[model samples]
Target: MSETSALSATGATESRLVGVTAALATVCIWAGWLIATRYAMTSSFTAVDIGLMRFVVPFVLLAPIWIRKGIWPKGLSVTNGILMIVGSGAFYTLMVASALEFVPASHVGILLPGVMAVWAVLIAMLLFGERPGKVRIVGYAAVVVGVASLVALKPAGVISDDMLMGYGLVSAGAFMWACYTHAMRQSGLGALEAASFVGFWSFVVMAIIALFTGTTIGDAPMGDIMMLLTAQGLLAGCVAVITYGLAVRHIGSTGASAFGAMTPALTALGGVILLGEPGNLALVLAVVLVILGVMTASGVFRRARI
Candidate 1:
């Protein structure tokens, strides 16, 4: 095994509080990123354009570290290398960016966390045999109902090809992310190394996609494009990616997955302040319900493991 794996094995039992805090930090960063991403997506910019920059910023930031580490982890098998960089990084980015094209940032905020939490619970139960208790199951139900209401109430003339596609894509991204988290744990790769590997390959795949699709430059408002690229590439890429990778390493896959539930609430709040998206009554109620459900599900309400 690699040194990263060995270190993980020795430190597995070090501290649960630390792990949980790390996961929480990741969620906060992601929530803030969601707001910025929504603002970045306008009639002027397409998802592909945003995605290209996501890869570019990270690749540039990691250039030195990558050079020093010699590009690619020593212990990463070829299959995992491809899966992490391509499957986890590039593919997920494609799904999310495309979805954001049609879906409201609020909808994304609600759905992203719901999908992630539910998937985490299911995957943990099936793959790792970890079962959430009764409270958590009920909490999961609240999340489902809350998300369903948002969809059911989607404005009547507003549903379009783009919106439907966006939802599907984002949901797929969530599922892929869940699988990636589990796979990383199973593979025993350390967080930093995994992040670096994913960054390298994501950059490669995105570049290929940009080339194939013919990257859209000077197509959107130059100012918006610049802002989007900087946020997605630097804040979301360098900071968020590195933080999340470290979080997943400290928290087990299941616990880390729980943090996703907060993304929607944070995003919704962001929408109100940043995007001028209305804070409807439904938004407030949904946020309350989701927050309570997440708390209950995380076993804070009861001593049961979720």
Candidate 2:
């Protein structure tokens, strides 16, 4: 091969490696966000408090950038800002936090990312006329079956009415996230631009809500509060968002999104280990199905010619 061709091959390989590494790290931090939020719920932190912390820390950290670039940024549209803020910002945060109040972290881990993959695919198909192969069809079916399996376990004294409500809320959050992802793809905002827009708007909106509701952080221990702030704001909110963007830029959105398949099992495991949440047959089965379904829907196996 020519020296230039060899150099190109090496660069492409390095980029893929970076994408895979970033994607995996993003998933791990996201899982930790779930676990930490669950812990916060049992403490003095309210859903509003947790939601506020998520944006406040990131917003403060990114303030200089806003000052330099201005709040709106040059390329990002108003619609992009609105969609991203509502989809992944305060709205999504509060939904997940409220759900944690009613259900285990394990449920959030499975339902949120699992349903998101399914929704992203369906949305693509509907809007773009993308045809699903046989493998993808089966994958979509598996996701449905996995979710239904969780619902089925409800009558066996496993899932409660409150849990069902939590599931509904989380699912809605996932749907909003799917919309956000789609909007971001078309928004022409770079990763930092999108993250900054989301952080700023989320902080403003949550602050307003907190003022109206008289929501305060209460007497939650400073250590616990700091943990929540760092995890939700810095790690999951900022770092994960940037890393996922890197993955998308490096390996394409399809490859980056396929990494979501690992999130369910990892989050479930984190819940069991960190939160002492019980792991059962149904949860395990759901995790397996979700991982398989997401992998299939994302075309991981198909691309491998498996």
Q: lDDT per prediction?
A: 0.71, 0.85
Of candidate 2, the 10-residue stretch with the lowest lDDT total is 150-159
- Deviation in Å, model 2, residue 271 alpha carbon: 0.7
Writing each residue's lDDT as its tens digit, candidate 1 over 97-190 gives 6777677777788877677668878989997799887878999888777766665445652567777788788788878777786667665566
Cα lDDT tens digits for candidate 2, 99-136: 89887888788889878877887889898898888888
Give me the candidate number with maximum lDDT. Answer: 2
Clashes in each model (backbone N, CA, C under 3 Å)? 2, 0
Deviation (Å) of 151 in candidate 1: 3.0
TM-score of each: 0.78, 0.90
Worst 10 residues of 1 by lDDT: 297-306
